[model samples]
Target: MQMMEYYFGLISVVAQSSENVLFLVKPILPIMLRIIAPVLGVVVIAAFAGNVMQVGLRFSTKPIQPDFSKINPNPVRFITKMLFSRQSVMNLGKSVFKIATISVVAFFLVKKDLFWIMKTMDMGVLQAFQLCLLLAFKLIMVVSGLLLILAIPDYFFQRREHTESLKMTRQELKEERKLLEGDPLLRARMRERQKSYAKRRMIQEVPKADVVITNPVHFAVALKYEPLRMGAPECVAKGQDLIAQRIKKIAEENDVSVVENKPLARELYKRVDIGDEVPEDLFTAVAEIIAFVYKLKQKEAVNV
Candidate 1:
């Protein structure tokens, strides 16, 4: 429709000019380039914008990969199956619907304009030409708007269908996991070895603790302090449940003081980590506990 309007305008310009056909022929190449440039520019921009909006920026050579199987000459098994596919059927239906709708719209518009033109028979040639152009523009706008509305749903459906088609089976998922994470047994053994080393290091630190605060059974937090070497008590080891039992047992063997302070033990276990200082809010309570433990140790030393 746009090309038709452009051709009409070009003809009108040429008709009004005093130049002969031979003279116009000399500059036809430049005129043709001017007309083709905008059309090509619009097509290129539309193609790029449509792809970007649908899938963003993606680089894939899969579509262009050579596949000899696709060149099968069997029409019933290959070509016919593709022709009768769901997507092909849907596209055919959409094309037919668009053609029917546009035809109906153009028929009514032309009918209305024809009646107006007939009623005003004395209208000038230029006026009649302008009226036809106006009608053509309106018809094009209506058809383009309808097609654009239809295209939005089709684009989303195609994207969703494509995604579902790419879903992996259980076997494929297992293969991908093996490729990415290596052998399961080997990974598990490595994890266990790491935990064993960490637990041994934690047990070694427990002997250096000045006091082991306990939630009595569930939680344990070991704190160490030195007047000359440290400013405040720092947690040396902390654990719960089985690890807590192990920490208390190791402290007992080392003759470290284990004080039962449920509230302080639970708070330190939750808030403080190994090698971290106790929070300022718990400074006074922790200081009193440390002082009591120190006094007990001094008295035991004097008795010995």
Candidate 2:
């Protein structure tokens, strides 16, 4: 049997060793995924929130794969960027400020407990040291306050870094968008159809407006009044740019009054909604417009 084992020694395997276990660990990619999963999840959620809060997301691929080949390695750039610029200066200032504050607090606390310290000294050296510990506690409290202040900038910088790191290259952005949106031509055509439909609806509604108020040529707000439903006139529509000019043209074609009360027009557009009552603040302003429209209607009735 011994001779057989020597010849077939390969048939027996030694138990797994730490080195073997570590080798197994190194090859397993999922182990690294499991470790970083929580961090990735946090980053995704934070990036989403940051996108919403910041400039409403103009997606770019520039941040994702930035070129650092031309990175400045000059002494000024290195010193300023590495740890001595705006953020670092703020940090250093904060640290010195906190130390000073804590020191002042500790000094006051030590003086306040001086009587206790004296009494404790008469009792024993240990009790006197305990009295001095009161100052330490006050210092801790002041230091904690300073830390809260310091954490504000740290949180902002973390979000800023996250934003910078997420930047992508132009090609990366196009590829990612292609993957997500599919057939760019078809997507653009769909958008044009939607815009055309909205335009048709706007054209149809412009004729029914009681008054079309214009900022001469920039802004247009259309109002409609229903005595049974609305306590006062409500804005049916408000548009700017090409839509505003279109509204004015349609108002002229439909014989609807194109009022020039810029302030009243602005107020109606700002404070009122479609099919809602005009605000109390605008009551006087809108009442005057209504009176003018009514008189114009009375005169037209006589002419007919």
Best by TM-score: 1
Residue 201, model 2, lDDT: 76
lDDT of each: 0.85, 0.73
Can you tell me which runs of candidate 2 are displaced by over 4 Å?
Answer: 1-188, 270-277
Q: Candidate 2's error at 275, in angstroms? A: 5.9
Off by over 4 Å in 1: 1-65, 68-86, 98-200
Q: What is the lDDT of residue 219 in candidate 2?
A: 78
Worst 10 residues of 2 by lDDT: 2-11
Which pairs of residues clash in candidate 2, taking residues 3 or more apart in a chain or in different chains? 61-168, 61-169, 62-168, 62-169, 63-167, 63-168, 64-167, 64-168
Clashing pairs in 1: none
What TM-score should be assigned to candidate 1? 0.48
